[model samples]
Target chain A: MKSLFFPVLLAALLAGCSGTPSKVASIEDRSVTATETKFVADKPLVETMGKPPDATSTSSSLPLPAAGRSGVAVETRGLVAPSTDVMGLAEAKAAEAAAKAADTGATAKSGGVQDAAILPYSGGMNQADMKDPASLLSKRRVQFDYDSAAIRDEFHAMLEAHAKYMKTNSSARAILQGNTDERGSREYNLALGQRRAESVFKALNLLGVPEGQMEAVSMGEEKPLSEGHDEAAWQQNRRTEILYQGE
Target chain B: MTIEIVGGATNRIPIAILPFLVAPELASGTSDPALVVAGDLGRSGYFKLLDTSTVSGLPADPESLPLAPWKALGADAVVVGQIKPQGSERVEVRFWLFDPVRQTRLSALSYTTTRAGLRGVAHRISDAVHQALLGEPGAYGGRIAYIVKHHGHYELQVADADSQNAVTVTSSPEPLISPAWSPDGRRLAYVSFEDKKPVVYVQNLADGYRRAVAKFRGSNSAPAWSPDGRRLAVALSKDETSQIYSLDLLTGDATRLTQGGALDTEPEFSPDGLWLYFTSDRGGSPQIYRESLSTGKVNRVTFEGNYNVSPALSPDGRTLAFIHRRDSQFHVAVMDLNNHQLQVLTDSTQDESPSFAGNGRVLLYATMVQGRGVLATVSIDGKIRQRLSQGGDLREPAWGR
Candidate 1:
């Protein structure tokens, strides 16, 4: 009778433990679940929560249950077993708690300071490939003498490379973006950038690049690479950016 | 521009043009002196022509340059010329300009032109006389500034009045809107949204100096300078109304000029300093309006286009050049305030900003070509147009005197 009574009590306790949710398993609805997506998926740590016992819902199931509920966190406080596995489980639970606390803390104060829009570059091309002088110079940027649109001779190598790339790669397209330094009026700059981009486009088309593969755009003086008040910065800003569209 | 006169007729520079130098063979049958004279003087823009009938009693020769009769005819100067065929496909042209007020020859010159170049000789002589009377160089070698945009971003640029030497001045990382120049032409005041909000910045051309001028709450855009350079008239939202307000550069105090819920922008001061010309959507689509300083009365100036902006008031306050959207593209157009005549300048390019030179003969505008913004200019007559393709493609050029 004593052994039967102990077994019956254990069964009841186990049933109750499987009914409640774990403390760390606070799953909110509408939050995206694990998936392959276009944007960055929910931060990596979001799905590290353990599955709950007897909870079939994949969308919103708690990790652990209370003592009165099924699949609650392992209740070592009242457990008769003094095994090391239980102790290891307890350490894991503690570590997860600490990690959650730290994550929340870091997120709360991540205010925007470096707020200037960084150039949006998410293509397959990496910085190393771009660092090669040939590749770097191959970028469709042309420099002009002050107050003149006549193409200079120095950009020949770069433009020729771009033309070659365009001729060889049928699927690749390039957008030439004309830019200017802070010198004239906004409207004037916009028009000037357009003129510069058009000149480059015509040059490319004349040099064997397909007319249909290249498009010209004028950003005017709005996009500057260097943020200085000096002439060097101005020179750098006075450039045309050749953007690649899916090679 | 506000031109206030005691009797309601403003002051004007009285002037005249010389007769067109026609070959003796061309004018062999006719002795009409008026037709010859009108062509030369009208092109100069320095003279208000007096009718040959008004000076009906004046002598035809230079010695008989009847001073009393010319004065009665409102003639401030007289021009006499001789054109004879040189037969080398050329003609011998001799001309002299006389100041009727002083009764003496102010200047004289001679030129030999090929038969086909006779008109060219006439224009050059007209330009010379125009320069002499105006004391300032004629508008023969000047430029205009205006605005232009491609897919994104605005460019304020400068180009020759004939649309040559188009150069970009301010290329921003964001959209640039209005561009106005200081009276001295050293700095350009324009609106750029670099901080993600419309802010006015004055950029110095001499030393790449750029700094925020006004960052008021809401929009601090549409900056126009007073003729004296002491104040900047801009459209602000601090009053919860997009009204015209003048900001004191030294003290940074903004003074409201209009009080209403109507959205008012594009404030340009009349040359006389007594009125402000701006655009308001109060009645409907954007139209140019003038608000009197002394009387606080508002009057509409533009009626043809549903959309018009970037008004460039001629130095004499007689003409207003602005942009109007038509057929899905904007083109620069000028309005004769007295006659209310409107003329579109560009064909298909999106002309964004337009400004006039001090002489009021040249206009600078910005337009897009080949996807980049470029500055262009045209004479009000719509003839003698050229394009300026300066490096770093530009837009929104403001021409100072």
Candidate 2:
């Protein structure tokens, strides 16, 4: 009982000094598969920290095998925790474990190339560049039929490209501005616009992209791209424009 | 351009309005009360106003004037008034409605008001004259609340029935839509996108004190005032999909009315408060539906068109005005509840947001004129149309009280 009392007191002191410190420290001492469940439980804490920084710095320091395993750990620590002492300690410990796992695990052989593949396109692509016709991201609009939000087969390639980019680049954020034609009530059109945006959001989520990276907003029929009252203009007005942050 | 149509209908009753004579003490300002009355009567589309400038020797006193001249001018009725100084800043207007055919005084009204309220008094006199002759309720003194999008700003404006005295109630950089007036005409419930999300706000017109009534997650929009004004029927997406919900203004508690995975919105209350009308896609396409308050049984209201939305019932609860799509063109249509007779009311291809007047005689709606949103009104008989385009791109008009 005397031996347990000192360790228990030390643990309580550690928890008191930092909120949810034990929750992070326990993940560092566990295996990758075992820690996944714990990571899931601690996701809310990570999300509460807001958007995590780009994983670019984390992957650069650690070698292939360790970074592969530690990639998951780095997400849980760096994104979950902030600049607190406990977060720094957890991030360092996870890096060390990832390095050790890379040295022992056989799958660590191709980890370096995989980490490079996950890095976002950092070359001259900014908000203005997104509007450039030459840029692949310029084709960001998803048009819908009258009173319908279902993405046609023609837009699958464009939507899939966006989904792939968002999945690989977690730090990037985009806003989907849904619009409708001037036919129905303004309030009903607002809901229809939301449904269109949510349809795109669902598509991105199905591709493994997180919902935090995308915000769905409906502009309804207030902002119309085409002022014509004919069917041709209505078709153009019924669309969703994908605008990235700072764009 | 502001469209003005007066007294040209073949069946209209011819009326004459004499220039109101002002006493020397209060005759400083050039306030034409008789002209205002003529304009009001002309807009009603029920009266044929005789040209008053053509008549000679018009007397302000009804007892002193001879009705032979007005009868020669083809006027069934002639209205004459005198404005006298009531106080330092107030004026008293006494008007007499004379039946030219009978050569007898029909009615008389004595109104005391400030100089600023001269138009208001004139409108009241017009209402009295209309009631005495037409045997119908007049909307001369009522008000209308509408939203105007100008210079990238959304402004909520309240104006008198004749499009005079327009007061900007509120202005915001974001979009403001769905302006619904309370039954008493003292409050307006509307949806604002100020927070980058749709939220319903109830504002007191007297003091401009506004409070957000619906700010739940997802969206809180399309606020419709109940007949009693104690509750608001709103559309909320808090449950992951848009659904109709009733919020008690007194208790601040919201009760869900419709349960479905489809979108339900644009709620309006029946005149008797027995049913709540709303737009829903539960039948695979958007259409108007109403649910009985006591029985909780829902019934589809519009079956003729493939798409019908934004249902606004008439004041007498005999007609339902909504946006109906015919051959890909959206137009305002009214269906008589008693006979189930649906009549298309507008020729515009993009007519939306239909609102009924205080009297069930006319309706105000939004339509596109030269690619700009403008306000238009039509009598329920599908005749007598007028377009008001002075304001820039105005929409979502609600006539009340």
Candidate 3:
């Protein structure tokens, strides 16, 4: 009983059916699968790296598996719970904006990317030369705002590098698909998804990549990345997929 | 350009709308003179359109005009417009509205637009005319909400009157459809299958707080709230038949308003709360039937539309709007309650879930576009038209009371 008390309390805390620190903490620690199921959208942050995001499939299922079992753990942490029947998406643009400002402020105060990096396990391709697809895809997903279709300030450096690469690679024809979660009406969601795709498209265009090289489309709430009915799954669904039609 | 024609109410000065001229370049995309004229006028609900077909009332030419016989027509106003082709896809149009009574030009305006935007330009003219005559706003810009079903899932959407803005409100693998709004414009009640069973939920618009309102054991759906915001009338199927029942929110008491094996759903209260109008197949084909609150007398209102599911009353208490199928497509149509006259507001499409805008000037219904569901609105007069954007498939958009 003593061993499990802390974990149970933590799971309830994260789930927050009751709004308390201990309760949310209990929700956080409970059985990885049985928490309230959040329908996951089709696109994820990883897909945003190379293409625009499609929002349709994400809200369909919760925390569904990605293709080929990519070791991506959907972190629901404090976002959503399972017991709630209807769902929505994050209005996370404001927080992402604040985070970027803090990053800049931290850079001015404490020095380099070492102090500015929040995720201990993730450091994006900030110094990759233009045209490297691997580094480009890594930067767009990690540093974006919630419910924001716009690529982030932290992402601009990465996007510039990616844009330069795409401009140089004349054979590359890219399709930027935008997406969103199941929080809004499908029409607004699709438009929002398109906006996200367009944002990424604009970033690539700024890199001097010709508009002809890239196209943007929106698929609002049609697919899903994870198949659980909890927050962990929904987080995995809110993303854009960049289809790299390679030469 | 703004025009002010103010006069005392007693004398009631007669006014006329000069036929607006479009440069030949701008007129290419337009089909009929009436489409541009009526799209602006009827949507506003402020026009007293006169038939000037016999009158030789004409505007001054930016081009050739045959003079004479202008005095015989009783028109007290005239307008002349000029056109210049800007490019293959663009046109520059100039128009002037004049008061023939005062013998002075009321408005002169010039604008440029894409060839595709000519309809919008004409609507702009209508807006100017409305501001000049009645001092009220025009309805060429507002949109509507409706419903559509795809793969058994229902979705609510917002769109222009012309069937654009095809957004999906909620799409579920298990079907989240049948959207209706609260009278206050802040909440929506919809049917969902989250429990893997049918139930209706009331969702707050500001916060998305959803809670089940009717979750009876067997089947509880088709919820319609009264105008006073007190009772919720719902249809629950029990023992192989669906019947209408009213639930008192405060008392938790359920009152059965309808009985029998025939489906009695889609109950909407008249503005006065004296009558309840609903759709029933009790008379064989689906049609609107009204039941009096005082007498409990039921009377069938429609005899035309073979398939009419959703019915919305006009805000004026004069018309009943519903979907009528003709030639394989369902179009939104309005019937005069007294004369039993049917006039189709939308044509050549599958339109359903008719809801009156707040003023009762127009109707909103859902249709399909390229197999995707969309919301569209049409004026009650069947004149003005506009289409919104496209999303996924939307279904059953009910405007708030």
For all predicted structures, in order, the TM-scores are 0.43, 0.75, 0.44
- Runs of candidate 3 exceeding 4 Å displacement: A1-247, B1-173
Tens digits of lDDT, candidate 3, B174-202:
44555666665545666654443346666
Residue B263 lDDT (model 2) = 89
Better of 2 and 3 by TM-score: 2
Tens digits of per-residue lDDT, candidate 1, B120-230, equal 344455566777776754564343445545334344554333332334444433666667778876567877655434567776543334567777644466789898888
The residue-by-residue lDDT of candidate 1 on A15-56, one tens digit each, is: 433334343233321122111011111121212222233344
A24-46 in candidate 2: lDDT tens per residue? Answer: 33332121111111222112222
Docking class of 2: incorrect
Q: Write candidate 2's Cα lDDT for B1-401 as tens digits.
A: 35565223559999998888888655544377998898888877888888888878865554577888889989999999787664343455778889988989888766655555677778778888888998977778777778767666667766667776555556565678999999978788988775555778887665445678887766678899899999999998777568889999988899999887988999999989999999999998899999999998999988997889999999878899999999978899999888878899888888888999887888899888778988888888777877776646778898976
lDDT of 2: 0.72
**Model 2: residue B270 alpha-carbon error in angstroms:** 0.8
**Alpha-carbon deviation at A140 in model 2, angstroms:** 4.3
Per-model RMSD to reference = 35.4, 25.0, 25.3
Error of 3 at B153 (Å): 8.1
Worst 10 residues of 3 chain B by lDDT: B1-10
DockQ of each: 0.01, 0.05, 0.01
Candidate 3, residue B278: lDDT? 78
lDDT of each: 0.57, 0.72, 0.51
lDDT for A30 in candidate 3 is: 23
